[model samples]
Target: MFGWVSGFFTYETTKSVVVKSWSVGIINRVAQLLIIIYFVGWVFIHEKAYQVRDTGIESAVMTKVKGFGFLNDNLMDVADYVMPTQGASVFCIITAMVITANQTQSKCHEMDQKFKCKNDSDCESLTFSNLASGKITGKCIAEAQRCEILGWCPAENDIPIEHSMTEVEGFTIFIKNSIRFPLFNVTRGNIGENLKTLSCTYDPVNNPDCPIFRVSDILMYAGEDFSNISKKGGEIGINIAWVCNLDEHVDNCKPTYKFTRMDSAFKNSVVTKGYNFRFAKYFKSEDGNDYRTLHKAYAIRFDILVSGNAGKFHLIPTVINVVAACTSVGLATVLCDIILLNFLKGAKQYKAKKFEEVSDSVSRSQSLDLHECSQKTIKREEKSSDDSGAYSIGHQV
Candidate 1:
C-alpha cells in the first residue's frame, strides 16, 4: 500500500544533457542555423507570413472610347461607331453592319436566298433568336422558292458588305478604375492627377502609367491581329490586378494591366466565329404605316475585369509566426541527438549519459527492504520465544 501510494505521488522531471565536444556542438549549431534561415528567409520574409491578407475587395470601373473613321465616303465619329453610347465598363465598337432599310410589317420571303422549296411542308417556323428574321407562314412563294414569313417586309438580306472601320485601330480607350480594400479601409485608383491623360497613351516601357490605351496596342498585347479581328468582331478581356503591401508607401501600390482574347477558343470556328448583334430604328410613313430600318452590327466587345488583394502587417500574425519560428528551432536538437546516439564514434558513452536511467538500482533497493523486514520478523520471533517459550511451526526437529 505504501509503495502504491508512493508511485502515485511520483513526479518525473526532464534531465538536461549538454555535450562539451566541438564536433557535436558544431552539428547542433549548424542544424539550428539552417532552421533559422528557413524560417526567416523563406517563411517570414519571402512568404510574408507576418502579414494579414485581405482578398475581399470592392471595385468600380468606367470606360470611354473615341475615334473617327471614313466608310462609304462618309465620315463618322464616336456616336456612329460606339454602341450603347453610355461609356460603360462593357461596351462594343461596331466595325461592319448589314443594313435593310424601309422595312414594313408584312409577309415576305425567307432570308436565305439559297433556300429553295416548292411547298410549305419543307419550311419550319424560325421564331428562335438569330433564326427568326420574321414569322414563317410555312407557305413557299410561287415566284421564288423562298418560304413566306410575316414580320418585317422585304426581309433583311444579311449579306456582308465589306465596310472597313480600320481607323478604329487608332482609337483611344480611357479607363477609370477605383478599388477599395474593406478590411484595410484603403482605396486606390488607376489614374493620377499629375499625368497628362490627353496626350499620353499606354505602352509597357515608355508610358505605363497613362490611363489612355490604344486599340491596336491592346490587340497586340492579346496576341491578336488587328486587321483580322477588325473584319469580324471579337471579345477582349482587360484584367486589372492590384496587389498591395501596406508596409510600403501607398503610391507604390499600382495596378498592372493584362489583355486577353476572350473568344480565342471560338476565333477559328467556322460558324459562330465572332460577336454580332441586331437593332432597329423605327419610323412612321405619311399613311401611318409603321416602317423601320434593321441593322445587324458586327462589333468588338471589351469586357473590363478587375481583381486584387491587399495585405498589411498585423500584431497577431507577427507574434504567432515569431513564436512558431522559435519553436521550430528546437527540432534541431532531435536531429543532433539522433546523430550523436547512433552515428558518432563515442555513441555508446553518449547514449549512457543521455539516457541515465537505473532500473536495476530500484530493484536492488526493493530487495534490500524485503530482506530487512525478514530480519526484523526473525529477531522478533526469537525474542518472543525467549520470553514466552514459543516455537515456530516450520522449525526442524
Candidate 2:
C-alpha cells in the first residue's frame, strides 16, 4: 500500500540522446516529410481544414411556362397548355390527352377480347381494386361477346393516342430560386437584375445570369428532343447546385442549374415508357344529375431539386487537425526506435543501454533491515568475548 501510494506521486524520467545513423536518419526524415506534406498541403491548403461546414439550406422556387398550341381545330393559349393556370415550383403542361366524355355510373362494356365469354359461368365475380377499373357483373354482352361489369358505362378505350404539341419547343420557363445558408447568414438567388432576368435567357457562355430557360434548350441539354417526347410525355429534372466558399466574395455564391432526363424514352421499350395520369372534370346537369369527363393527361414533369453546402474558417477543426498531424509524426520516431533496438548490428548493445531494471520500494527496505541486523549481531559477539577474558584473569589471581 505504501509503495503504491508513493508511486502515485512519482514520475518515471527518461534521458534524451542523439544517435547518428544514415539509414535511420533518412527513413525518419522521409516519413516526417510525407506527413508534413499530407497535413500542410493536402489538408490545410487543398481541403481547408481550418473551415467549418454547414449543409442546412432554406429555399423557395417559382416557375412560369409560356407557350401556344392548337388542339381539335382550336388554338390554345398558355393558360390552356399549362395545368391549373398557376405558377409553381413543379408544374406540367399538357402535351397530349385522351378524353372520355359524358361518363356516367352504369354497366360498363368490357373491352378485353380475352374476357369474352359464351355465358355467365365464364365470367368470375371479382372485387374492384386499384389496378382494375371496375368490378365484374358476371354478365356477358351478346353483341360484343365481352363480359359486362357494373361500373362506369362505356369503359375507357385502350387504344393508344399520340398528340404532338411540338410548338411547346418554343416555350419559355422563368425559374425563380432563392436559397439561404442559415449558419453563414448568407442568401443568394439565381436572378440578377429584374430587367436582365426578364430579357435574357440562360446561356452558359453569354447570359449565365439569366434564370429564364427554354424548354427546347433544356431538352437538348439532356440529350432529348422535344418533338420525340411530346407525344408520349416524359419527366425532366432541374438540379440547382450551390457550392459556397465563404472565404471568397458573396457574388461567387450563385446557383448553377443542370438538366437531366428522369423518365425513359419511348424508343427504349413499350412497358412503362411514358408519364401519364387520369383526372376528371365533374359538373351538375339541369336535371340535378352528376356527370364527369375523364381525361388521361400526358405531359412532361419538371422536378426541381436543390442541394448545397457552405463553409467558413473556424479554429476548433484547425487545432484538431494540427494535433492529429503531430501525433502522426511521432509514429516516425517509433519506427526508428524499433529499427535501432531490434534490427541493426549494434541493436543488442543499444537495447541494453536503453532499458534498465528498477527495484521496488518493499524489496529495498527489507534489504536495508537485513544488513543492520548482521552488524548488531557481530558487535554483541565482540562484547561477549571481552567480558569472558576479564573474568578468566580474575579467577587466576
Candidate 3:
C-alpha cells in the first residue's frame, strides 16, 4: 500500500542533476532503462487496467474494449483485438520516453586554447585556402614595412640598425615537437582545477628580422645554438620557408621576414602547462603541409596555468543512444502490460450457457408438437367415415 504512485509519480529533478554529473559512459544506459521501465509499467499495470470497464449502456463507449475476446483469455493470443484501441497510447508513451531521455543528456563541455604571433614575420602569412564551397580565401594580413632607425650609427653606408626592421624576430619555433598535459592521474595534485591563459616571449638571435636580410629565414642563425646531445626534447630542427600566395600565382615577394623559436629563454614556453603560440611560416610545401601540421606534430612548450574549475563530466553520444534504446524497450514493456491485462479480461469469458440450454429445450418441444399434430390428423380421418354421431359425441365429450 505504499502506492503513492497515483499523482505521486513526481519528476525527479535530482535524478536529472545526477545524470548530468554522470560521465558520458553511463548516462545513456540510465536514461534508457528508466524509459523502458516507465512505459511498460504504465501501459500494462496502470493505464491499461483503468481503461477497461462496463458502466451503463449509454456510457458504455469503454465497452468497445469488451469485444477484444472476452478479456478473460490470454492477452498474447487476443492482443489483436485490443491493439487497435491501445495503439495510440503505446506510441505516445514511446515517443515521450525517447524525447525526455535525449533532452536530459545533451550537455557537454570543451576547452580550446589559442596563440598568435606578435607580428607578421613571426607568423605565417599569405595562406591560400580552398574552402568546402570551392571558394578561395586569402589569409595572413599583409602589412606595410617601414625602416626605423634603432640609433644613428657612427659608421655610414651600413644598413640602419633599426629595431630589427622586420620586427619578425622573437618567434619561438618548435621543432621535433611534443606536448604533454597531465592526464588527470598523471598530474595528480600538481594540476589545478581552473583554466587560465599564459603568455611567454622569446627573442630569436641575429634575430631573423635584423637590419640585414638573412637568406635562410627557415634556419635559426642565433648566436646561442641551443641543441642538446641527448635530444630529450624530441627530434629538433629549425625550418624556414617564404610565404607563397598560391591563388595569386606569386612565388615570393620583397623578402622581409621574422624569426622566433621555442627554447629555454622564455618565461613560460612549456605549452602543455597552458602557454603556447599559433604562428605563421613562409613557404608551404609540395607535401601539402603547413604550420598547422607543425602544431599537430609538435606543440609549443609553455608553463601550466590553471585559472578555474573544469567540471569533470562529459556527455557522449553513446549515452543518448542507450537512452533511446531503453525508451523503446520501455514502450515495448508497456505494450506487453496492456496485452497482459487484455489477456486477463479475456480469461474471464462471458458465460452465455443459459441461452444454449433454452435453445435446446425449444428445439425438443417443437419436435413433440409435430408428432402430436400427425396423430390428431389420423384420428380425424378415422372418425370421418362414421361422422354423424361420432363427430357430435366427440364434440359433447
lDDT of each: 0.82, 0.78, 0.26
Ranking by lDDT: 1, 2, 3
Better of 1 and 3 by lDDT: 1
What would the TM-scores of all predictions be?
Answer: 0.75, 0.76, 0.12
Residues 264-291, model 2: lDDT tens digits: 5444775677777788889889998878
Each candidate's clash count: 0, 0, 47
Candidate 3 local lDDT, 218-290, one digit each (tens): 2243222222211112211222222222223222211122333334343244542212222222344576533
Q: What is the lDDT of candidate 2?
A: 0.78
Off by over 4 Å in 2: 1-27, 71-74, 112-118, 125-129, 194-197, 263-271, 334-397
- Residue ranges of candidate 3 with Cα displaced over 4 Å: 1-172, 175-324, 328-397
Best by lDDT: 1
Candidate 3: worst-modelled 10 consecutive residues by lDDT: 91-100
Pairs with steric clashes in candidate 1: none
Which of candidates 1 and 2 is the stronger one according to TM-score?
Answer: 2
